[model samples]
Each structure stands twice: as structure tokens, then as C-alpha cells.
Target: MKIVLPTAGKGTRLRPHTHTKAKSLVHVAGKTVLEHIVSRLASLDADEYIFINDDENGPQVMAFMAEKFPQLNCWATVQQERLGPAHAVSLAAPRINKGDDVLVVFNDTIFVTDLDRIPQLCADCDGLIYSKEVEDYQRFGVNVVDDQGLIVDMVEKPDTPVSRLAQVGLYYLKDGRGFMDFLEKTIQAGETVKGEYYLPAVFMNMIRAGLKLKAPTIDAWLDCGKPETLLETNRYLLRDRHHVHGEATDTVLIEPVHIEKGAVVRNAILGPNVSVAAGSVITESIVRDSIINADSEVRAMILDGSIIGDSARLVGSARRMNIGDHSLVEMT
Candidate 1:
């Protein structure tokens, strides 16, 4: 089995923080989104992990991977053109072999599912497309399935409520070469949704060819693509945490907080959903529903729904922020 992660999006939604590092590198719950995804997929013990990234930061991403997860056989490929999901994943076709199990995951969201079930789930089907039931079906592409849980069709933000199973951009295919073949056909045929070619078209081609895909629902789908969702995801992941690493002198503690052992916290009120990464310092501030990345400094400030990037400094203010790495803010 192999894992293919299409991570070429320039996360404009996350802005300032994304301005410095890749969106997947932004910290949340004391780990990068990419780290969390890799951790989640560690259960598969895949033969290799392939990342298709934009040309500019491909080396940086590979460097980070080598430094953080040297145990995994990881390869990074450049998606020189911002074409589409199918095109981005096509970069990994050279590594994926015929009949190999391949999991294609988009890196913008975190999903809770049992990766161990891939063998049983794909035993009778060509692949599996995961989804979560959502009330707001109009906002997402959804899978239309039969009573047997076989996906018959997929619709992208339909005007009518055809299905409630919103696609989460996770798929496991038993035929790795077959998947790439369909992707190639779609690209050569210019089958596109908007101006860009997407994966659903490839899936449609597969379905039209009598390929069967099962629609499995996941327990949780946490989106980390933007600040609001990132804070919400932080809150979700930190719900069970209520501890501080060092002594908090003259400070109040709130439930669901994760202050790292290397971080410094004093004279502040922290919590009900906050995570301060290692080497960061917080003093005389109230931080709630926020994630402060590594080596950052916050002093005499109040924050909520904020994301502080690595090595950032904030002083003399009380507001929500999306500060990037190496940023400095001092209010008069």
C-alpha cells in the first residue's frame, strides 16, 4: 500500500500564517496538519508516502519530512502547474504499481476513520470513497449511493438535496494503476468541472466503466483550511487536555488547554481551547480558543480565536489574530 497526499494548495484562506510555511505546516494541537495526517495513516504501514506539492516549497517540505519523520519512506514531487487534484496526484503514478492499494488523501481536512478496515472494505469493491453526513449538502460534493452502500453517482454542490453524504476527499483504491489510468484518460479528454480538472471526473469515468466504489462514512471530519475552522479544530482536539507544563504563577487555568513543557506561562488566564507549542512564552495575557506555534512570544495581551505562527511576537494588544512566522506586532 502507498499513500498519496495532494498538498499543492496555496492556502489563501489561512493567510498570514500560511504566508510563511505551507498550510500543512501550520501548527494545531501541538502538531502540523501534515504530521497529524501522517500519524493517522501510520496504521497502514504503507510502502511509501508520496507528497505532491507546489514547485516553490517542495524541497522545504521534503526537508521537514526528513527531519520529523525519517522512519517513513517519503518522497516529494513538484506539481509545477496548479491544474487540479487529479493532475497533482498523477505525479505519483510512477511509484504506484498495478494492484497496489493506494490511498489518496487531500490535506486540507482531518478525518476520523479506521484505516485498518481497508482490506475488508476493498475486498469486493474497486475502491472506497469516504464521506460524512452533513446538513449543508449544498456546500459540498456528495456521494449518491445505493442501499448496498455502493456509490452510484456523485454530485458537486447540487441545487437539490440529492444526498447528504458530503465527500471528504479520501479514497482507497485497490487498483493503483487503474486509478492512474482513469486520471490520464480524464486529463487527455479535457474532462473538467470548472477550468480545472478534478478527481471526481476521473471517478465518474471509472464508475461509467462499471467500477464499483463504496461510500463509507467517517466519525469526524475536522477542517483546518482557515482560521475559524482551525480554532474550531483546536478546540475539538484539546477537549480532553487540561494541563500545564510549568508552574503558572498568578495565572488562572481553564479546561481544555495544552501548554507544552518548554513553554512559559505566567500571570495569565489561558484556556477553554488553547495550545501553546514548545519554546513559546505567554505572560500577562488571556488566551482562549487559539494555537500559538513554536518559539513565539506573547506578552500583556488578550486573544481569542487566534493562530500565532513560529517565532512570532505579540505585545500590547487584545484581539484575535492570524500572525505568521517571524511576525511582530506592537500596538501603541
Candidate 2:
């Protein structure tokens, strides 16, 4: 099977951070979001890896993957117009095997599932979707499933939802060409709203064509789309670590803290749910429930539930701001 990772979104909700870097390249806990997803995909028997990214970030992505996951046969397609999810997938159809299964994964999602169980599940269905029950369905693409776990209906961000089984952006296509044909039909029928064609419409088309669609419940799934979501995901990852960091320090930690390698923390109360990425310095600061990205310096500041991006400098200042990657802020 081939893996297609769509990372072209500008992530407007993430603001200044997305303005500077691609959403998939956002750093959390010493690794980029794309790196985390690629590492997970490496566990599978993937024959080819296709990356769909925007023109602005294509070069950076190439250099990044070249150094990180060079073992895999990788190729990239540029989405020059920033059309939509369906259009992005259509750009890579020529590279994928027509009759083989293709796995479409969103770059912002951190997927954790039994990779070996996917092939068998896809054998009996035209398309297989991954779903997770969340507290609220209005914030996501909800799946209306029957008692037998079949995805009978889907509504993307409905005003009034009937179920909380949100689609987690992991899809298995038994035949890549068949799915593309449905997408084409949706376009021809003028079903697009807001000039963007969503992937859910394709599923509706398949249903109209009498194809069976199934939903598999996932064990772990996280969407790192916004800054708040990023911080939440980072905290969830650090929940079970006595000493999450690989590096050592004479400074004391208050438990449930993650200090990455090469991080120096002295006389600081780092705890509860703090993630200090590699090459970051945290000294004399009380940090809790936040993500401090790599190569940044934090000193004498109270960092709580904040995201400090890569190469950022935070000093003894008490002022707090929603900072982006490669920023510098100092206390006067």
C-alpha cells in the first residue's frame, strides 16, 4: 500500500506560526509534527510515500525529509492553487497504483493504531474510515454509525449532531481509482460549497453507488490543528513520565515533566505537564502544562499553558503572548 500525507493547509487558525512555517513542520516535544507522523508510518509496509504540500513549503519539506526519513521512497506533489482536500488528493492519483490500496492520512493528526489490522479490514470494504468518540461532535466531522459499526452517514461540523464519533482523517481506499472517480462525479455535479470540495462528499458518492463503507474505532488519535490543541496533545504525551527527557540535570523536577536531551534546567519547578524540547534552556522558571519547542531559551518566567515555538527566547518577563516559531521576547 501507498501512503499519501496531505500537509498543504496554511493552518490559518494557528496564525503567525503558520505564516512562518508549514503546519506539519510545527515542533512539539523535540520533533516536528510531520516527523511524528512519518515515524508512525515507517512501521507499516509502505511501498511508496507521497507528500502533498503547498508551493511555499515544498523546498523546506524536501530538505527536512531528506535528512529524516531518507530510507523511504518519497515523492512530492505541489498544490499550487490551494484548492481543497479532494483536489489535493487528485494531484497524486497519477503516482498511486490504480488497483492497489492507498492510505490517506492528514498531516495534522497523530495516529496510533494497529497497522497490521488495516489490510484485512480494507479487504471487505471499498473504503474504511477511522473514528473516535469525542465529547463534542460539532467541532469535527461526525460519523453516524449503525449498531453494527457501519458508517451510514457523515456530517462535517453540523450545527446539531446526532453522534460524537468524529472522523479522525485516516482513510483506507481499496481502489484509489474508484475513489477518484467518485470525486470527479462530485465536482461535475456542482456539489462544492465555498469553492472547496471535501472528502466526505466522496464517501456520499460511494454510498450512492452501492459501495460498502466501514468505520474502525481508533485507540489513539489527536488533531494538532491549533495552538491550544498542540499544547493539549503535548501534555497528553507527558502524562506518564517520571523523567520524560533523555538528558540529565542537577536541577529538580516536580514529576510528570518532560525535559528533552541537552535541556538545562536549574532551580526550576518544572512539572505537572511541561514539555521542554531539546536544546532549550529553562532556568529558575515555574512551568506547567505547556510545550517549549527546541532551541529556545526560557528563564525566570512563569510559563503555564503556553506554546513557545522553535528558536524563541523567553526571559524573566511576566508578560505572556501567543508566540510563533523563531520569535524573541524578553522581559525588560
Candidate 3:
């Protein structure tokens, strides 16, 4: 089985953090997003690994793979153009064979599913596409299935209430070469939306050709696209509350908080959806619903709904937070 991960998008929503590193390298819940994703899929034991990275992030990804997944046969390649998803996947055609089982997953969103069972589950089908039932269907590309639960069509941000099974970016093709040929034809046909070809078009064309593309359901879809979702994923991951490093020194730690090794917290209240990464210090501050990245210092400030980047120094005085009765003073 060949596993492909496309990390080409330079997470502009993540700002200063992504400016220096790839979006997948962004730290969350004591690990990089890429690390969490790779670790989760480690059990699959894929035969080959293909990482689609941007030009600037290729070295970083390769370095990460060398350290984390050194035993696996991995190759890092760059997506020379930002045309679309189909174009990005096409870059791996050189490494793909006709009958190889290809599994393409986007790195921004991680889904919870038993990937080990996929081979047996899709043995009778030509391909599989994982989707989740979402209420906000218009915000994503949804898959339309027939009575047999096979994908018949797909609509990107539909005008009406088409389908709630939002495609969460996990695709498996039993015939990898057929998928690549469809992608090439998609590019040649000039079938594009917003000036770029999309993966839905390729899959739809494959379905039209009598391919049984089954739409399977996933357990959970955790999106790490932007800051809000990154923090949200942090909270979701920290649900395993055993992450606290010894007893807090002069600090009160709330549950569901992850304090990594080497993070010092003193005279502060932290928790209930917070993660203090390694090498960070927090003193005389109340941090909640936020992620304090590595090598950062937080002193004497009330931080909530915030994300402190790596090596950032944040200092503020809380003495002026005192306000009289009946006055609601909220920091924006």
C-alpha cells in the first residue's frame, strides 16, 4: 500500500507560525500536527510513503521524516505549481504503479478511523472516500451517494441542502494507475472551477466510468486548518489528561491540560483546554483555552483563546485587572 500525504498549502491562516514552518509542522498538543497524523497512521505499516511538500518546506518535512519515520521507505517531493488538488496528486505519478493500492490523505484534517480494516472493507469495491456528516454542509464539498452507498456525484459548497457527508480528504484507490490517468484527463479536459481543477471532478469522472467508489463514514474529523481549529484540536487531544508533568510549582492546574516536559508553571492558574509545550515557562499568569508553544515565556497576564508562537516572549501586568462591582471588563 502506498500512502500519500499532501502538505502543499502554506497555512496562511496560521500567520507567524506558518511563516517559518510548514502547516503540518505546527505544534499542537505536545506534538506537531504532522507528528500526530503520522503517529496515528503508523499502525498501517504502508509499503511506501510519499510526502507532497512545497519548495520551502521540503527540507523540513524530509528532516522530520528522517527522524520520526526513519525505518519507512519515504520520499519527499515538491509540488511545483499551486494549481489544485488533482495537480498536487499528479506529482506522485512517477512513484505509483498501475495496480498499487493508493491512499491519499490531506494533512490539514485528521480523521479517526480504523485504517487497518480498510483492505478488507474495500476488497469488493474499486475505491473508498471517507466522509463525515456535517451540519454546515455548504462550507465543504459533499459527496452524494446512491442506495448502495456508492458515490454518484459531488457538489462543492452546494447552493441547496444536497448532502451532509462532507468529504474530509481521505481517498483510496485500488487501481492507482487508473486514478492517475483520470487526473491527467481531468487536466486535459480543462474542466475547472475558479481557474483550477479539483479532485471531485476526477472522482466524479471515475464514478461515471462504472467505478464503485464507496463513501465510508469516519469516526471523527478534527480540522487543524486555522488557529481556532488548531486550538480546538489541542483541546480534543488533551482529553487524555495524563499529560501533566509532576505537580505544579506554585501553580494551580486545571484538568485536561497538557504540560510537557521542561515546561515550568509558577504562581498561575492554567487549564481546561490548555497545552504548555516543552521548554516554555509560565509565571504569575492565568492561561486557559490556549496553546503556549515551545521556548516561550508568559508572565503576569491573563491569556485565553490565544496561541503563543515558538520563542515568543509575552509579558503583561495583571495589577490593573481589578474592577469594581457590576462592571464587565472583557479583554478583546
TM-score of 1: 0.93
Runs in model 1 deviating more than 4 A are 317-332
Model 3, residue 319: C-alpha shift (Å): 2.3
For candidate 2, write residues 1-332 as lDDT tens digits: 88888889778887767777888888765578889888887778788888898888877887899999878898998988866888788777777766767889988778778877876877767778888888887889888877866778998887886878888989988888787677777867877769987888888788878888888888888778888888877766666665655554566677677777777787677777777778888877888888777788888888788888778998875555799999998853
Estimate candidate 3's alpha-carbon lDDT, on a 0 to 1 scale: 0.88
Q: Give one digit per residue, the lDDT tens place, for model 1 in 1-332.
A: 98999888789999998887888888888778888888899888899999999976677778888989899998888898788888999889999887687999998998889989888878899999999999999999999999988998999998999999999989998899889888888899998767788888888889999999998899899999989999888887787767687546787888888878798898999988889899998998989888999999999898988888889999885569999999999963
- Provide the lowest-lDDT 10-residue window in model 1: 239-248
Query: Which pairs clash inside model 2?
Result: none
lDDT: worst 10-residue window of model 2: 241-250
Residue 89 CA error for candidate 2 (Å)?
1.1
- Candidates' C-alpha lDDT: 0.88, 0.80, 0.88
Please report how far candidate 2 places residue 300 from its true position, in Å: 1.3
> For every model shown, what is its TM-score relative to the native structure?
0.93, 0.89, 0.95
